[model samples]
Target: MRTPIKRDDLESARSDLLATAVGWFKREQDVVGIFLGGSVAAGSADAYSDIDLRIVVQPEHHLHYVERRREIPTQWPGFLFNEWLPNTQHCVSHFQPFGKIDIFYYDAAKLTPSPWYRLQIRILHDPRGIVTDLVKRSEELPFLVGESDVDLSISKGLAAAHETYRRAKRGELFYAQTLLDELRHHVMQADDWLHDRTPETTVMAKFDNRASGEVLSSLAMSYCPCLDEAILAALSSLARAYRNQVLALHEKFQLSRPLRNDVAALDMVA
Candidate 1:
């Protein structure tokens, strides 16, 4: 059996691993710049936080690093597995000793200005000052989502929740649960968008202390071993959370409230 990792040990391992990565990047001639992003850079890192590194290379050497991305992690200790995202610009590597690293490769010439570049970042190596220039350019860019976009997302969530109820009533338990999960995802995304934050898969992290605890409680009630109980409980909890979210949005942003009929439909299921 694998031993549980202590928090202090995990933090130390991450620190050491990051130092090793800095050394490796500095030695590579093709790597023009490197910056740290994500939780660590944001000063919110904990034992569970993974290392996020942005490697900026010359355009001519971009594909060279991409082709050999799999071998890159092997240079670090405790390499286990790596998965390349569909975007082909990032890879996630899991290590033995309780560490994961998210590596993003950006071609210096192709880099675009965005709000993400404005976020807290730590420059580890930048011989040509390319990453610094990118950060400065991104600071002037605006990132905004219209109220209509948030409204549409909530509407979609309601429709999906109704479909989930229908599936449950028809004894399609598996699909019903699946659709219910999707409904939760939509709600979480809407909430994040409403608050002018990025929609992340880590749902609880997006909410405040009280709301996060409530969401966790609702999730617990939604999952059950028995199909019928699971369906009923999941739909009921989803409807409650969905309604609360919509109401909050309407009150805060003066967005149109959900249709009465749709709210009634969800209410019926609960």
Candidate 2:
């Protein structure tokens, strides 16, 4: 059965699932701490939001847990399956009756927090006060992007759009579309820095909630149907938007706009 995006029963079921998971983690001797992140931690969760559960393991047993990360999520009721985020210790656990959870494993001894905790984290279990203290320290750190990062983001975005243009001209729509999507992320990162917000670890998530309408609207104008001509036009539009953003970022951060020559070369495309 398809679950409604917003429903009271689904909310109740999710709360119950979270409560049950909390109980299980608290009883497990090796599990040191538990905290929520993502939309749940930000207090903006809707019925469809996944429970981002950070599971802190006993430092001595961290390796053992990491080896069998799949075993942990399988313990949840109604668990359909879990998929690991590539090259990371995080898993997205999907369930049948109601909801989903993102389980992130952390080593208790090696716990080092960052500014991410300031925006998205709610501690539920911290017996040793380790996670609590780290979170407090992280919250004090400023969440601003560096000039080099902005330069890299805009340069790469423009480069990707150029690649997309080349691929579209060659009739490789799929690959062109792929690069176009990558360019979108580059735009998002640039936008984050333009407004002095920290770029999210998970790209393309919560951007709608955080970004200004002007940024979004400009990007929206670049979207087009998946036809060769349409895609070529989209690449052009995206390139123009990036150019404008480069100038804006230049004024805001005194960025060097190192991609001016590359962008000029890209604009020579028909």
Candidate 3:
């Protein structure tokens, strides 16, 4: 059985695990390169920050490595539990003495250039200098989503929010909240696009723009358990923010404005 971990011992535990990982990577022949990113590479890691690793392997050995990914934590010390994320390429492992590591395995030949590739990264092992070349190429490429995609996201969020309001009016509180969650997700994605940030698994608190962060915080706090109150609150917050985003898009590009029909459906006095 795995021993219980104390919160106070998490940092030291993670440090030891990282050292073990670096050593293992250096010795593994199939592993072509290893890069460290996320909060640690970004220099913003706190006691609560989890370790993130990008493992690049030989193209021919990609499937072999991925299939055996579960064995990774066992090779290290203090592994407690692990959860595979929806993406087969990613996994999160928890360790004894309290800590988590998020690992992403990639085929060196199949790796694509994106914002993540350019983020603060430390190449731990690159015998052929493949990662160095990729990093250099990533810097020359612009990481951006098209304006049309941003417009579509805003429209989807508004439509979902409207449906959520309708569901709440019909007394389907659970389903309404479910749709509200989707609306929130789309809104956050739109925010990411506005700032030229990758929308994937973005943490709102890490947003560089203070106004965007405040908007997200306000929308989160607007959620309520009461059905009618929640519906109105969610719709109001979404509509307000959606309008601002739409206006910003129009100002920057020639995008069409989002319709305000959803806000009109809400009964403000109720």
Candidate 4:
């Protein structure tokens, strides 16, 4: 479902979610702070959007506090619940049903703080101020890095090679359109990150900015044989660009996850 673009409606839903969360927390133990994070906090959300809420607790109670999450939305509207402890240095949990929620646990004496996080975050209620303070500390968190670098020249060279060896299959156009769409969205997100300073944008938005306004529109439509060479060229360019983009980040920040590694699949029409 497409989420609406209105800010007020989001805020209203936010207010409701916050109150519900706060009330739930009150029944458990010490709930130090509550905040807003993610797309809603960044002032961008769609009709099908979910909320991102962060619950902050005082020091010394980290483990005890996390244990209470399982029963959080028993009576509230929730579709998913996922908790993540990225590392031993800090404890963070994400809750999603109507939206997304992040709960940060902290010890005031153990750490200082930083300025911003990748995702937009705002303190809603911080009785002891630990939540806001922890937010500052988390900003200083260094990202992990990796070492493999996939050069664009290699990707481009491979693209040229593929054009010579592979026959134009029955689903070539379909495959081309899918790759074009993926490229468009990914590029748009890269632009949004650099342009708006917003950390997240839909994958589709990421590639939307890579090509000319017209070429993008055309790429989304059925592939015309006349443009086959051009489309292949673009895919090769993107694959190369992403290879380095992914590897460089992996080296610096250790950003490796289970993404499809099948470059050959890009050539497949299906």
Candidate 5:
């Protein structure tokens, strides 16, 4: 039988792994800069936060690191396993006694300012001032959610709601449920935009803590059993809620609704 990794132990393990990883990268001549990103950098990290390590390699040496990204973390203490993320230069490593790290290798020359580092970042190592310069340059980057994005998400959500209702009526529970899930994301994005939160930020991060009571209340009605009647009821509730969100966005951002269709499929959704 395996013993559980308690909250305290997990916290300690995480810190230990981070220190070791950062120390290793600092010793590498090809590593021009290093910084911490994600929730940990934002000061919102909980017991399970993964170490989001940004490793800036000397351009010519970047490919060498990318080729062996997965293998690099094996030298860290308590090495268990690691997974390669879609981006070849990114690697997600998991450790035995329990810890996780997301490492993204960047060529020093290609680093640019972006909204990603807008929240918070900790410079672990910046021998040549590369990471420091990136942070300074990123300070002026703004987060933008245009009118077109809000309109599309709202319109697409309503269309999905209509399709979900039809599918549920036809007894196709699987696809209906899938569409319901997708519709949740659409509304979530719309809600983020309406609240002036960056849509590209973490999905539903501390939702109950940050989201308005109205959004919370409507979101409650969006989840239901897989049964046809229940699914249809949920879709109806979500359809109206999506429309209300669109109206709110219009009032907030002065964005025009791109598509207002027949209410025959989704009543009161204009």
Candidate 6:
């Protein structure tokens, strides 16, 4: 039977692997830099988290460097290993030793100005200055500057809100389904941008911090506005709460920027 790897087991294995790697580095005097990235470095590691490792070498040694480290994983068995050369200067290695490992390679100078630059990183060994320089450079890297389009939301939202007013004007139920759908999309899009995840939690509930009131009000007013006063009051409360959330994210991340309606407004909200 293949033994199952638990979170504790992965942590222990990483500790052991790092120990072995550090000893090898000390012996291999030419090896200049080593660092850890990915989930462990971010303090969000779990059993499924992969080890992200990087090693920097001297420029002259780049030609034969892959040949040198290719055998490193043989030190530990039961690991499923795969490796790739991302560029002439870099190699990426994946090792699933009871868990997963993602490794990167680079020369000392190539460490900076790479798109893979991560904010949170841990240096295992830096006999030369490459690791420190990369860390310093990462802090100064630019943040996201979103693209802009149009804010058709004002007209769209008001139109939908007016429809709900009409429904309320009639004796029928005041449902805000259409407005709710649009509102949900924008709120969800903003969350996706913030979390950097494709799928996020639901937009409902008082605990959901990312909801938007303008979106919600437009949604609610588009819905069953002709419903009883209590129902309308509840929808109004939800819209207000969602609006507060939009404002908060707007202040913190500049998420309120206008954008092309070409992309779904929700997708562009962030």
Supply every candidate's count of residue pairs whose N, Cα or C atoms clash at under 3 angstroms: 0, 0, 0, 42, 0, 16
TM-score per candidate, chains pooled:
0.81, 0.87, 0.79, 0.47, 0.83, 0.50
Worst 10 residues of 6 by lDDT: 198-207
How much is 53 displaced in model 3, in angstroms?
Answer: 0.5
- Order of models, best lDDT first: 5, 1, 2, 3, 6, 4
User: Positional deviation of 8 in candidate 1, in angstroms?
Assistant: 1.8
Candidate 6 Cα misplacement greater than 4 A, ranges: 67-71, 83-97, 113-118, 146-191, 194-270
Task: For model 3, name the residue pairs that clash.
Answer: none
Q: What ordering of candidates by TM-score runs from best to worst?
A: 2, 5, 1, 3, 6, 4
- What stretches of model 3 exceed 4 Å from their correct place? 1-8, 85-87, 192-205, 212-217, 256-270
Best model number under TM-score: 2
Candidate 4 versus truth, CA RMSD in Å, comes to 8.9
lDDT of 4 by residue, 58-133 (tens): 5677556556554455456533555555353322223332344444444434445543453466677777777666
- Backbone clash total for model 2 is 0
* Of candidates 6 and 4, the better by lDDT: 6
Candidate 2 Cα misplacement greater than 4 A, ranges: 1-6, 198-206, 256-259
Q: Rate the local accuracy (lDDT) of all candidates.
A: 0.77, 0.77, 0.73, 0.48, 0.80, 0.52
Model 3 root mean square deviation, Cα atoms: 4.2
C-alpha RMSD of each candidate structure in angstroms: 3.7, 3.0, 4.2, 8.9, 3.3, 11.6
Tens-digit lDDT track for model 1 on 1-270? 979889999899899889888889889999999999887887777798899999998999998888777789887888889988564877888886889998888898998888778778899898888888889989876766667877777778877788887887788888887888888777666556545565222222435442355565665566655386677777887789777767667666776655575567668766
Which candidate comes out best when scored by lDDT? 5
Candidate 6 lands at a TM-score of 0.50
How many steric overlaps does candidate 4 have? Answer: 42
Scanning candidate 1 in windows of ten residues, the lowest lDDT window is 199-208
> Where is model 4 more than 4 Å wrong at Cα?
1-15, 26-28, 75-112, 117-120, 134-270
